[model samples]
Target chain A: MNARVTPQDSALIRSARFRKEREADWRRLEDLVEKAEKNGLQNMDFAGTRDLASLYRQATTSLAIAREISLDKALLEYLEALTARAYLSVYAPQERLGGLVGRFITKSAPQAMRRSWFYILLGFLCMGLGALAGYLLYLENASWFYVFMPPEMAGGRGPDSTTAFLRSVIYDDDHSSSGLGAFATYLFSHNTRIAIFVFGLGVFACAPAFLLTFYNGLILGAFYALHVDRGLGWDLGGWLSIHGVTELSAICIACGGGMQLGMAVLFPGRNTRKEALRLAGKDAVKLAIVAAIMLVAAAILEGFFRQTVQDMWTRYLIGWTVGFGWLAWFMLGGRARQ
Target chain B: MRSPAADVRKAQRLARKDRRAERGRAASTILPPEGVPLNLPVASIGVRLAAQIADVLITTVAAVCLVILFSALELTRPQTIMAIAMLLFFVIRVPYYILSELAWNGQTLGKRFLKIKVVAHNGGSLSTHALVLRNLMKEAEIFLPGTLLLTLDQESPVASWIALAWVAMAFAIPLMNPYRQRLGDILAGTHVIHLPQPILLKDLAGEAKPMTAAKPGAKGFAFLAHQLDHYGAFELQTLETLLRAQDKFMSPDVHARNRRTVATIVEKIRQKIGFADPIPPARAVEFLRSFYNAQRAHLEQRQLFGDKRADKHHAADETPQ
Candidate 1:
């Protein structure tokens, strides 16, 4: 036997002793983790899950002791990693897909939109300004329409194009079924892209979002001008009314969501910029989703109803009814007890 | 003597101090609550960037393959092609991130490669809601502006500048934050941390010999049952770490330094435990070794009886007055 045991010897002895006592449980826990990692926690039976939870608690206790006492670096590291993995496995939040979708639609999305009404209004004002500008510019000189609207987007619907051609494009069902489907897809994708752009660009202090929203409105106004200059304003209104109410509203709401994010960054009240942004994002993202939903509704209307409904009055009636329905839903949807 | 309540309070205070000191040492990383007891190290910006680059490269390759595939299909209508393109972007690319993160437990392929994982800031498991929110935000943060400028409007100087600005802001947010959380991470209450390095257990055969031989009735300092109860596994492990460091310092001067350290530890432990035995400076190491053995045996026995102590403080609280 050694005459005098050095602290080094003592420590080594203590570690050995400690490890010997705990190694069995640690090994058991490690084996469980390995099994869970391979086959997932679902593979474990009720008994296995219970055992895992008990073992995890024990391991966590062991980790706390190891950390507090400053155990051997390797053992400490092992416990830390093991406990973290176990915690993740044990406490993972599981939600059903249907339930999640239901919650989003019924409660979260509408609540978020209602909360950010100021931004939505601002988005509408910007779009309105853009539309007015586009209208005035195109009215003064038809050449301005070319600057704002790309040829591909115009699709031969320019100032130079005859009134009959423009009216036919909106009202006539001469195009083949496949051709209509393609047109609907094109219109839906184009509008969806703009909606996404308005929402995404809001990160840059809402400037780009405002510009994009206004640009969308400008295109709409220029198109309106093209029809109005040729005494087809009422016919164009009926055509646009079929889908424009839902589509434009969706765009405005998406832009509003973007503006909310920008507002959070610019005016963080009592919270850090990050905290503000995060809180704002909870609502903003919901509005964007709601906008996307509206876009889909609009796409269906634009695709099917706009092409089929030749009577201007019926189109107006359908458009106004759908628009009013959406307005009521937003204003009253998901309201909590006062 | 001290009253039992006083003893409990002192032990609790010491445990709290230890935790505070640990937190102070790792101030750069955000720690969960004391109840969780996790010590996660935040992944550095460089590692995060590398992981992102890898992901982007993978997605770009996939996008290219898709474009080629679609081109080969030779769909007659431009609308059909545009529709396919939109579907590819929204369905394939977006869901790739969401589903992968969900399936892989907060690690994408790139994150897995770098040994970094997204974890909940609250020390809970990653929730589905968080996964969906974060991945959905990715479109706004990185992909949307990128696609708009690079593919949609390469000719527009204004659009290009706006995209560049957006990208710059996206990158800058994480850099400015202490936790290195991007917008999505902040919104979702998640952050990426480097996975702990794998632990390789060393050969403890030689170390085990002395411990086994110096068992009960061995030539070492004797401890009363109460003294043994004063500490738990925590103190035992601390003593072990101190002893293990001796092999690193082989010089005589270092040996002298180790003795001083050993004596200091012995005195502190003796006072804390209220041990009245007078231990010689030369036999400090022997006393610690004997105490450690007795404590380990006591803890193991208690564990078998379903009365396990979490640490020294916990052991103290369990001691009969």
Candidate 2:
């Protein structure tokens, strides 16, 4: 209703609309460009807007005459405006902040998270179950508990299997060098990898991922419960958390990917669920790639740092520091600058 | 490019035609006609491009921030905890956007900042389920044959070529529309629109002046008679109030008082103008436009100067010039 149609006003809606209209024309354009490139047309200079419009019009008219055109007048006009807007972006650029802010606001904050929460929680719950299952399996044969802890702790001890097991989990045989650092590093990486698996499974992936997650969870729970029963829970908890924070975040990312896929499959909006699932699966893979990096970092931390620190207080300090550091970095750093 | 002069002339003619019609209607009857909203203005190429750029920058920053937060936990902690944290963030944050845009009329934080809204072509907000469904459709929006088309060879199979063709078409739907749309919009039967301020009385006055000068068609006269009969005196007051207090106008509820006031005025106007003929809404608009312009001119002139004094001053001003 406004008396003007400024090129500026039509920018945002153009790309999507252009894709819809002239589907054939766009394909043709891409084809022509590609063909031209193949034929060494890269350096060929083209004319201005007038030429492009005429060419486009000719193509569109031919399609219309052949009764092959699908777009209506209203849609066509919309597409034209959008196309004009798109052309401007290539020639005269805008600030990057605008683009960043737009994506953060539109794509990341709410909708993406909502679509992916279920698998995350499921992954968490599965880990606990996994830990518990491991515990029960250990209890079935008490003599085998030492074997479950690791190989090194049992090396020197002829009796006192419990002592041997603790040694293997927390320290080395030499006692000159504590294994706490190594164990911590291993735990961080191991947990993160497990988390990744749980998350990346998606719906089909989610099932196995969840099972693995639950199995790990149960093992952790049972191991801790056993330690508490022996009055070593505090030491264990402090020792474990040093790298747990980062490792856990990685796992959650995996679960997030899985959830996205599951949701896509379960609720495909305009398309069939199968199609949705396929798309979600690809995105999940992208997510998993990122998750893998986190898992690796967690592994290094667990293997090196956690196992080396012996004093419970010192361990707690390091654990809290890393945990809070990550928290502050993610939640506060970007926002504080803004 | 099209001739700038031609475009300008065409726009002016359209404006003039609208103005004259408005004046004609106002002169014929005391009652004013209901106003129609203007078409949504298209977004410029620059803004659309900015929107894309914004999306990428925002996601990267957010991801970086999330990574930093996850780094703080002690190495000794169970790996599962980090896993949980990641899962929580991803699940809660992602879909919230898609749902909000679909349900609240395409207004996520970014869209809201951009000042655009989505609605059904028929003009209504989407429901929660529809919003949920739309969000889920991101799979298609993000993936689909567009990617495949981009990668395929020129001499691909007919089916492959056809698929590429289909996605290409889907993508263009929005551009072809006054309201830019893509395939999802077509499938969902929705449109995006820009909301602007209401039209002013001056603009209306300018539009109406010339229409009343033309010879009246029988259809126009008949419509005028209908307006006078259905809405007469009271409709005038309501319209005047609307125009005078345009800045402060709120959508008043249709209670008996308002309904009766408007109805009585409409009836009076119809009786006075006697526009009872079968003319379309577009043609009928001409009469009201002319009437509005004449009325506006008369009122402005009266307010601007006292009759004799104003004329003597005008003569003096002309003499000095």
Candidate 3:
């Protein structure tokens, strides 16, 4: 009994000494990580941050050693949680407002738009085909207008409406400018919602997204067909062009972004489908931001310019210029430095 | 704005205290970039649903408030007021989800209340790209379908049924998965894990009498070195649990049962290790305490020499005698 007792006494003493030697470093790391989590890491000085990193490393090392040598359950759990909190602190995303906004605008957004060129073109193609179908169907039968557009959306401007009424509706500049704020807000909210919806539904292999964009184009064509029958086709073009170029393109690009998500899943190449989707998601988010910005721009133009401007020539020129500018921006915006 | 801190803090402390006393239940591991597998418990399905409900309530309240505020403004056109009221929650939800998660490190106000958090599934940093992707998916998966079902255009039972199916499918995704990830979580490569409130209790050493302590009416057991080698860390943890639980709060019946259990454990240990002397009834507790301290130290020494006995199986694997 005397011989057995001696080794146990010494073992207990050694374990206590080991813990006492390293406990200070672990405590310091725990304090720093907690402070950084509650506040921000920027509040700490350079020396403090350096010490935190060093202490975190030491704690991890101590934890590894403790696992092998210590039977203390409390110490083991404390070390495990401490390292996890430290890992989160050390690797947490730290985005500065200025750099993020600048980078998103000048780099990421434009680059994503450029990358999604094929999907965007495909979105436009679907829209174009739907437009052609609606236009031909309307020309074949004027009553097809009701079939293409619901009365609520058409706002009583249908095949049954007089040409005079249609023309007056397009050139209704006498509407109160005070209501422009409300109009812009409504349009921005409405279009942005549809854009986001189209983008989000793209994950089901692009069919849903493509079909929705096509459906939107059908409405556009049916409306134009009604004006054509009234011989106000070019006038309708001028009226729509002011905001249509921006709004339509924004919606299509959103479709493109969604389709990219679909494509990533459908054809993940070598990477697993989830990894591919995540990468596509990164690009798609940028495109969604672009779509949102364009929709806002469209809302502003429609409310302030379309409601007030009466000149057809000015309208056509502004529309074409903006369209070309959007095209050029996507093609070359982020590549100037490169 | 309501403080979830005080109440949750208490519950969290008790939960962690229970965790420290109990043996590990093999909580799922998160492999951080440091290559260390941190065992964090994933939030349960009920908890996640409750959190979502809380979020929905908050957002709906905000929406109703917006409706009141917008109507109070008395906009001349009813169209403007109608538009605002109709889509308030839809608009409010997206920004509320994205911005709060971004600002508060992947915790929405609801998540903060429940003490669960969105962590990267691949153990990477919680990126803004991921947060945006996930929350955007939330609209397609949950909000749109949920709203449609709630509105339930009664004329068309078919559309209502479709919306019902969509909502069911959205909810079922999380239930079917190992990580309880909804469609958004799957897309974003993120999962919600329960945030542990780890409070290290004072070690068993604090409870155990020192080897030199000469207690009244009893002498401590002198455990042999080879006898200490009979068990492993797994057994030691179980012993730690047994030693930490004092008889203070136990009911009279429970206290009697615990004493019997401890006596049985002492008999088992004495026979397994071939200890010669008989420990009296008064000294059984002390005998177990000193034995635990000595065995834990012996195990630690062996572990220090890179011979970790994870469980009782180490004897069959290592000592061939």
TM-score of each: 0.72, 0.35, 0.86
Best by lDDT: 3
Candidate 3 local accuracy as lDDT? 0.78
DockQ of each: 0.17, 0.01, 0.33
Chain B TM-score of candidate number 1: 0.54
Worst 10-residue lDDT window, candidate 2 chain A: A85-94
Candidate structures ordered by DockQ, highest first: 3, 1, 2
Least lDDT summed over 10 consecutive residues: which range in candidate 3 chain B? B19-28
* Candidate 2 residue-wise lDDT, B266-311, digit = tens: 4554455554543344443344443333333332333334422222
Name the candidate that leads on TM-score.
3
Candidate 3 lDDT, tens digit per residue, B1-321? 658898899899999888753532333577776666777777878998788889999998999897787668765356565555555776688789988787767788899899888888788888877787788778778777776776787788977876777778887888776677887787788988877665666666644655336455445567778888789889988887887785358998998898898889989999999998887766677777788788887887787777888988897886666
Ten contiguous residues with the weakest lDDT in model 1 chain B = B197-206
Model 3's CAPRI class is: acceptable
Report the lDDT tens digits of candidate 3 across residue range A74-165: 77888888887787677666676567678777777788887778888988898888888889889998888888796767878998889999
For model 2, the superposed segments whose C-alpha errors exceed 4 Å read: A1-118, A132-165, A168-193, A225-231, A266-271, A278-290, A307-310, A325-338, B1-321
The local lDDT score (0 to 100) that residue B280 gets in candidate 1 is 79
lDDT of 1 at A165: 92
CAPRI tier of model 1: incorrect
